[model samples]
Target: MTKNDEKYLIEYINLKRHEYLNDLQVLLGYAQLGKMDKIFEYIQKVIDKCNDERTVFNSDMDSIMKYIKNKIEDK
Candidate 1:
């Protein structure tokens, strides 16, 4: 990805870092529109969410990260 792509991805992660769930939904909507850039962006958000909610994903963190990483990489 280019620098701006990286920047937006990090921005997405930052939003999720604070648990902005509603906004996350909107961003995810954009991602689902086949907007690879936006999908990559929201994937970072999801990764951050999964990271911050470790206790909630105690058994799935690794798998979740692996899946998300694959999606991001595939983009």
Candidate 2:
């Protein structure tokens, strides 16, 4: 592929990665707010999306929790 094409692909992947991270953040926020059901439902949606894409997104709860904690602490 051309350098320009690779650059565009990188940008696209970065955007999608950030989108997934944002979704995870929202789900974690819901979980912390006593909305376990909502969290589970949203998590299932994330899982389904990952499965359909043949990708594994953050299977480790500790890492996921750490990311959320860092985001919360950053503010």
Candidate 1, residue 9: lDDT: 59
Q: Please give, for residues 18-42, the per-residue lDDT of candidate 1 as tens digits.
A: 5566667777788678687877777
Query: In terms of TM-score, how similar is model 1 to the real structure?
Result: 0.31
Write down the lDDT of every candidate, Cα atoms only: 0.62, 0.66
List ranges where model 1 is wrong by over 4 Å: 1-32, 55-75
Choose the strongest candidate by TM-score.
2
Against the hidden reference, what TM-scores do the models get? 0.31, 0.61
Across 11-70, the per-residue lDDT of candidate 2 in tens digits comes to 656666887889978987997899999998988988887685443224564454444444
lDDT, model 1, position 5: 56
